[model samples]
Target: MATSVSVAGFHKPLYSTTFHGGWGTSICGDNSTVLIKSVPEAVRVVKPVRFLPVMKNINEGKGLFAPVVVLARNIIGKKRFNQLRGKAIALHSQVITEFCKSIGADAKQRQGLIRLAKKNGERLGFLA
Candidate 1:
């Protein structure tokens, strides 16, 4: 006989267990393969989980004063931080472009984000 177990957030039963008095129980979860295959390709892409705000701040001319900027300077040293800060727009564009690339975003999507960053930076009185 097969026994089913339900888990929260999953539409179907997660797995099944078969019982045999002498052998105890055998567990199997054939649905895992199905679940893995069901995931969308876009969901598999890798992207930065943090630092988006930092990118935005830098683009808005808050380079040296941004908390993340201060943290990064502390972590990477002032010399390297200054190098990136000297070319804020380039650094911002590069960071956003890299994020887009990591997430497998198409060229149009990448360009749109870069443009938005530039617009926001300009509106905030920052040069980009």
Candidate 2:
């Protein structure tokens, strides 16, 4: 649903407003009650459960696996997917943390390992 807002004063030729994901604007010639139509609410985006925002690579099956991602999104839905993905990522991070602790590795080593993993992933190509 879209809503219109009334501004009483603003004697300006152009007025504008912005929202996340995009922007909109309005224009008026004189100082009057301006009825600016607000941009409609953005359609809620359903991010895939398996997608990691941290991975900035393009070949992470964004195009090739789009169909599968859509199917999974339809099956698992937004809320459940979020819950599961969050738990899974947390668990993986915890495991990595524990392993680092056991190895007496500092932050630098952990980051280096992460970089090495990225490099290996790129070499593997399918998952990069």
Question: What's the lDDT for all of these models?
Answer: 0.61, 0.54
Clashing pairs for predicted structure model 2, backbone only: none
Best by TM-score: 2
Candidate 2 per-residue C-alpha lDDT over 1-128 given as tens digits, one digit per residue, 9 for 90 to 100: 34555556433233347432211223432322332323233643357568556846665544444456556656999678667756765675677778899999998887777667555544444232
Give the alpha carbon lDDT tens digit for every residue of 43-102 in model 1. 964786764543533354354334555577779998887787669878888898899989
Please provide TM-scores, in order, for all candidate models, with all chains considered together. Answer: 0.32, 0.40
Regions more than 4 Å wrong, model 1: 1-86
Question: What local lDDT does model 2 show for residue 20?
Answer: 23
Candidate 2: regions farther than 4 A off: 1-57, 62-70, 114-128
| 10 residues in a row with least lDDT, candidate 2 | 20-29
C-alpha lDDT (0 to 100) for residue 60 of candidate 1: 43
